[model samples]
Target: MNEQSLNLDSQKVDETFFTVKLPEQVGLSDQLWHLSKLYTLGIALSYTYVHTPFKCPRSYNVGYFETVIEKSKSILNKFTSINSSSTDKLIEFIGLDKHELNISDQQFELCNIVEINIDEILKDDKINSTSDLKKCIEYFGLYSKEKIYSFVTKGIYKFESKIEQIVRSANLDDSTIKKLKLPEKYWKAKEKFSGKFSIDNSKVKITLHIRKGDRTCINLNGKLVSVFASSIKVIDSTDYRDELKQSLMDTTKAYNLIQEIFNKYGEEYFSVQVLSDGYQRTFFTIIWAMVRGKIKLNLNDLKQLHKTKKALSKEFNDFLRFSNISLVVGESKQNLFQSIHAIVCADILIITSGGFAYWVHNFFRKSNQPSLIINLNSCDNKVVNKISKFL
Candidate 1:
């Protein structure tokens, strides 16, 4: 890892060349954002190195699957770094035509997969700052801290070649990547609508983005207070049962919002898009759907029910039903770009406004789309009224 001359502290880390240390475990989207942030910081300093994404955490195990993207291979190579010589090599290396049913065998055959040396990375004092690329600037002794701060705050991040390469390199099907790279016509509201399902180009697409993987009341409290009050007010926020109860209530309201849209648009006039972690909500939706005779329960759902706790899932399901979800997109950290593309395409987004939701909101803001943020801890009818206008 230390073979590169630029890795030394005395030499001053290259201002134009910065290396990212991928986390052993991190949401893929978060990792991409960090990469983009570092790359943007480097561009401000005029770095010339090809912004290459490291094929890291070589064997990331999430849920029930894993894969290894070759190191130094550009995900966006096909889209951005157009070199006739490298294109043939990357295609041959990726082996897009090869299919293997044995996952273990494929992982074993991965030739370049190697663990990163965290010790070398941590020992370098010049690489210590995670903010404003301070460690990099200090190591190189290039710009003042003030200058770096300004770039960090004001730098514009567009869907440029660097990011395109990374997204192209993600562990996604070639078809999806190709579709994403297609002209804007493929993603426009009218062009992307489904006609057979009765979806029309004129319908407003509403995406209900649900995420609660690592949420806590403390975070929600701060967000709600900031949006609704002038100052922070102390309330008994540590009621675990109440927290779960409020989640159920908020979910019901979310379902009601979908129903309201359906009523207004006659189901054919509007479309519902769902982006969820899928554990809690999926469990509840399945149970409710079975009750309403909309869908029959299957063995796999039964297994998940046993795993997620049948009692709580049953209670939550009692009030919520999956009426007309046009599309339900699962959030897989491995396919961050696909999730991002879907989120960006939505006409209206409904989210919780923190954690992953906060990140999505920023993306939407960058693209100039409107969203409704629900603070579940203290969500009120007023928020619902505001959302109704959008419907």
Candidate 2:
């Protein structure tokens, strides 16, 4: 465990990173955001590709590209650090003419698997920094007295804005939607507009983003008291209200489960918000929390090398980068565990577990979306046990 994210809070003598029981549900939207963002976070473990076109035998050209790729062990993760000599050798084997050779550069996608490491960052004192919280969290973990002020000043606003942005985009009452001023995009397919602040006139539905007042203590009353006073709140119909309520209830229950796990286990847990546009609001928030020492990587990121099927692994990275995310690409981790930590803390989940790490991640997926789970490490027994539950 990164000493930066976690420390011996109850250390009468010493503290250890044993898997302890947790009571509070550590369900934060950020966990899923980080998970989903792993496919999008732009922090690439970068190396230049040296293309060597292999013009195989006419018979070999008939072979599926997959077969040739597999023989070279060109899986998503086995990234070759290409150099000029390597490229030259590849060209020779491919039988390409030097005069005619023209190849474009391409990037090997990052593997979906991640390792979340809080202890490592903590040792180095790399907290998310908007202000001086970096220095404070370095000296103290998430709950340090010095960090408390910074948390309230910097962290709360940062975290609340994330949740608010997500809420504003979801279908909500016209009045509430207008007030929040969230990001919005028109859906040409639906002919109906959907955004952070949304309204469903056809469905007679309106959704309002209600922040977790008890947990965050945001600028709720300070601003809302005046805003709500000026705005005329709309009365919602029973059916429409029920649907939104159910959505919130279900999400809350899941979140509470994680919180319960955290309070009991004494582990770092957080939920990140998911946006309709596949934007990683939660992913950004954790990086924000890391600055404040509110969240850090867990111990699991260091424990194992998560495995996955090669194709699914490659596709996962491709989908996100293709989606046009610019800030970060893939979860900010190397190896399986670090990515896992970033995802869990970031709160965005991809919904598929067809890979090696799927076992531990099965329960974390949304039940309705079967395809979201990415199967990378498909053979492990523990990974299988977790995946089988949904099946």
Highest TM-score: which candidate?
A: 1
**Candidate 2 local lDDT, 1-391, one digit each (tens):** 6774455543412321100011111122322222222211111111111222222121112124533564465353237432121222212321221211122222212211121232232233333332222243233443322110111110122343333333334432223311111111111211221242222222211111112111111111111111111121112233344433432343244334323433543322222222121112222332334445654433432121121112212322322322222112222112122233223222223222122123223323223424223222132335323322332
Q: Which stretches of candidate 2 lie over 4 Å from their true place?
A: 1-237, 269-391
Candidate 1: where are CA atoms >4 Å away?
1-15, 19-21, 54-61, 64-200, 212-239, 260-269, 280-323, 327-341, 357-391
Once model 2 is optimally superposed onto the true structure by TM-score, how far is the C-alpha of residue 169 displaced, in angstroms? 44
Give the TM-score comparing model 1 with the true structure, all chains together.
0.44
lDDT by residue (tens digit), candidate 1, 253-326: 66666676566546654556655553433333344445666544456546644654444333334223444454
lDDT, residue 300, model 2: 39
The CA lDDT at 244 in model 1 is: 50
For each candidate in the order shown, give its overall lDDT on alpha carbons: 0.39, 0.24
**What TM-score would each prediction reach against the true structure?**
0.44, 0.16
